[model samples]
Target: MAKLFTPYKLKNMELKNRVVMPPMCQYSVDTKDGMPNDWHQVHYISRAVGGTGLIIVEMTAVHPDGRITDQDTGIWDDRFIPAYRQMVDAVHSYGTKIGIQLGHAGRKAEDANPPVAPSAVRYDGEGYKEPRALTTAEVEEMIEAYAEGARRAVEAGFDTVEIHGAHGYLIHQFHSPLVNQREDEYGQDLPLFGERVVQAVRKVVPADMPVIMRVSAREYVDGGYDVDYITEVCRRYRDAGADIMHVSSGGEGPVGAGGMPVGPGYQVEMAAQLKRALDMPVIAVGILDEYEDAEQVLENDQADLVAIGRAMLRDPYWAVHAAKALQAEADVPVQYARGYRH
Candidate 1:
């Protein structure tokens, strides 16, 4: 049997396989309320029925303006808990553990009247607003918001929680040299904000459940940090409380050759490097949709898990298909057993 179908565990969150459905925002919220609707339910629950080991819910906002667009989900208030509880319970019924990625969009918030970031540096992208810099006090408030979001997640019955510290969001802005030009604590210590977020999240979550943190190993933008630098930064986050590093790349600015390769497994080396450097389990993502390619990652010891994004969007039963192809135990629900029978 391939390791892709083998059960894996992290702290208290045990999985039926090594497949992970990384958070990809649906932007399907009908109202500006940040609640998960029927669209979210069918989208996620179908994947569970299809046999994904661990499903990380899309990057949900910790504050209102934290969302990239008004269509994204948010957990800034308690009223949102019941809706998430429904989603979480539905996903669990099929034996898949679910977690939510809590994040803040910072300067990239498309709907924010004027977004905020560590520095006044506007994303400078088309249609983006010039964001005001967050006050030091507001930054602290933001950290607490993350903690509160986790608290609500627990009440909603999430099996685990992920901190969205990658892809040039608020935590990323605080750490990226170009995005963060402040002279204060966060700037002086690039990983401080992320660490504080980890610590705060740890405070609310159960001591047994592992915390997953998604990080960009290297930036595609010129002058942005590299894998080597990000590894050290991640070391700080690990010490703070993050147990797994979901390694991805770029989003801070425009794409330029930052020396990272492109193509299948292009991001695996970065994940491998961080796994070696940080001594923490890592999830390798980007273009690893092919069954063999995804299996090769684990076989090669590059990453503890592989995330299938676009491919899974096309077919919810991607994990089941991979199992059949690999001749491993396919987690086909009994209702659909006839479809997968040889």
Candidate 2:
């Protein structure tokens, strides 16, 4: 009876509900081969059984050096495809659509021998190592790598693929002038890197397979870009073939007085802004945990979808719980029906 449980169609993938299980790294790849092992299969399949509509697997690396930790899943090689196929098949069996967040951690790649970024500056926090500036040639290669990873995702049977451009990763590094201090084309055109990556990814996947781009709508640090600039960048991404924008905030640098408020639906405004600017479906994420709060986001037209992160991590059955709390039809598994009987 709530919009949160309504079926929403994007491209060819139709979600059973608007509750999205945003990617949270499991860091359980014991082989370091970037393949999803039994842990990954169980982790994601459980969410499907728990009734999440769209489950985007953790930030999977496009290259080995792109991983934040060596344990992060990857699609950098064809060998990873079969493993992903197994998980995709398992998740889909529960009527849940699956996707993967393909990204390169860049300077944040703690496991890399010497991390790379658009510039040589190290991240400004503790435990961050200095990074080398990616050569012009390497930049081009990274784009191709993203395309290839996307290609692999399709082969692995994903309903969609998300480009992890948010949270100060490689794509975010290029979008934010605070980190992209180069003399070349990328520096002159900050959003060029993201646009190119989007275009590259679009070229590799099936035309019907939706491409979602996660973006930081506002940077918290001084001199960093704001919602206005990010809206423009998102426009470019939309033009470059992104179907949805996963709107988030901060992570470019340290927070300041102007940063986002610490409360529920804090970043919903950013998602609403992007939806208005780009005229595209947008996912709002950031502390939106409560069923009523999530419903309000949709009721107010703030976002097309609501991503539950920490809450979903705490309770895999978050969607089911929210459905019951809101008096909507809860998508409980038949095998568990006895537990829900009045």
Candidate 3:
């Protein structure tokens, strides 16, 4: 059997295959209320029909100001639960597990009234304005927003929840020393923000529901957190109740400073390194485009799971096609079976 078609278990969740549709911002939601509309339903349902074992929805904000785009999905209020529930139900109907990526954009919040961060540093050239420093009380509120978002995710019937701690977002800003220059508790310690977020989310999420931490392993900038630092962060997050480490790189310091050079499985080594250093499951993402590449990552035990982003966007049926090319039995939809024969 092809390694990519093999089933894997993370905590209590069993994924039918290693093919995961990583979260990609659609910027397609209705801006009026941050609700999932027909566009989201069609976009996500297409992936499910196309045959990905796991489908992680795009970066969903815990609060309105946390959005990367005005059209991004939001789980901040109970009103949004029904829309997500409809989408989740649709994805599950196709026998695919669905997960949500919950996050706060911090200083990167893409509006005039962006939320406060640990510092006032602007993400240079990323079009993000300098944000005000969040007061301790406001920080506590943001933590509650995350916990509440997790609760709503449960209500929405998602199989899992992933905390967005990478790509120089709100949590990433707190983790990078270059961005977080405060002398307070959140900045005096490197892992303070991440630790708190994990702990808070765990408190609200069901114990059986896996909470994955998506981390940017290498900041890829001077004075930014490197693999060593991220490895340590992974260890700490595991201790704080993270079920898996979804390893990806870039998005620290200046916009382009941490830009990861694109190539096949470019960031797989980060997952491989973290797998060696930690006892938790590690997911390798970025530039994973083919069956052999994914097989190598799994066969070598570099990553317990493989996540595909842009490639999956290009071809939602990539997983089923890869399974066929690799000569593995893939669960292709009956509607498309005839095309596969030719």
Candidate 4:
């Protein structure tokens, strides 16, 4: 059997396969209000139907002002519950577990509100503006926002809730020395923000619900947090209550160039590093499409779970295809069995 198709258990959650749909922002929510519309339902349901083990809903903003785009989904209000509930139900029908990635974009937040970060540093390049520094009280409120969002995620029937701590997002800004220059408790201190967010999330999320922390293992930029810094953060998050660490990299600044690298498992070394440092399961995601690559990641003990992003988007049935290519006899959904049998 392909390791990617093998069942794995994390805490109380058991995944049918290692194939996961990583969070990809759609920016498709209605302009009038941030709500999950039919586009989201169809977009996600198609993947679930394609037989992925875990499908993470996009990076939903924890607060109205935390969105990266005007059309990003929001969990701050109760109005979003029904839409999310329906989505969860739709995905569940395929026997696939679904997770929601909760985030606060912070300085990366776009739209009319501009953005806010640990410091007033502006993101490099166009469309970027100087972000207002978040005050101590505001930081406390942001922590509460994450907790509240976790509560709503549980109420909405998600199997897991992942905190978006990577990709130079809110929590990441606090971790990166390049953007965080404050002498205050939350600034010069690298792990304070992540530690606090993890603690707050633990308070609201149910004990049974798995909490995953998505982190960029390397900033890919000089003077940004490196593997050692990430290891410390992951250790702290695990201690605070993180069940898994989803490892991905880049996003230090425009110089880092998020998706410029084009190679298979380019960021797998980061996952390998974290897995060696922490006892908790580590998830590896980045340019992972081939079955051989996925198998090696597990066989070499680089990661416990393998997450696919653009590859899955291109072929929703990539998991089934991979199983066939690897000569693993996994069941395909009845609707697509004809193609597989042929």
lDDT of 4 by residue, 1-342 (tens): 778888988767788888899999999987748798989999999888888899999999988878988899999987888899999999999888999999988878877365888999987757877899989889888988899988898899999999999998988988888888887899767778888889999888778788999998888665566789789888988998999999998765765543356599988888988888897788999988887898789888899989999999899887777888888766588877777665
Residues 67-145, model 2: lDDT tens digits: 9999888888998888899999999999999999999999999889799999999988888899999999999999999
Task: Give the Cα lDDT of each candidate.
Answer: 0.93, 0.93, 0.86, 0.86
Give candidate 1 regions above 4 Å deviation. Answer: 257-260
Candidate 2: pairs in clash: none
lDDT (C-alpha) at residue 110 in model 3: 75
Q: Which residues of candidate 3, in runs, are more than 4 Å off?
A: 255-260
| lDDT value, residue 47 of candidate 4 | 87
Instruction: Judging by lDDT, tell me the better candidate of 2 and 4.
Output: 2
| Candidate achieving higher TM-score, 1 or 4 | 1
Candidate 3 TM-score, C-alpha based: 0.96
Candidate 3 lDDT: 0.86
For every model shown, the clashing-pair count is 0, 0, 0, 0
Per residue, candidate 3 scores C-alpha lDDT tens digits across 56-95 of 9999999888988787888999998998999999988888
Quote each prediction's TM-score: 0.98, 0.98, 0.96, 0.96
Model 1 Cα lDDT, one tens digit per residue, 212-272: 9999988888888888889888999999999999999988888876454678888899999
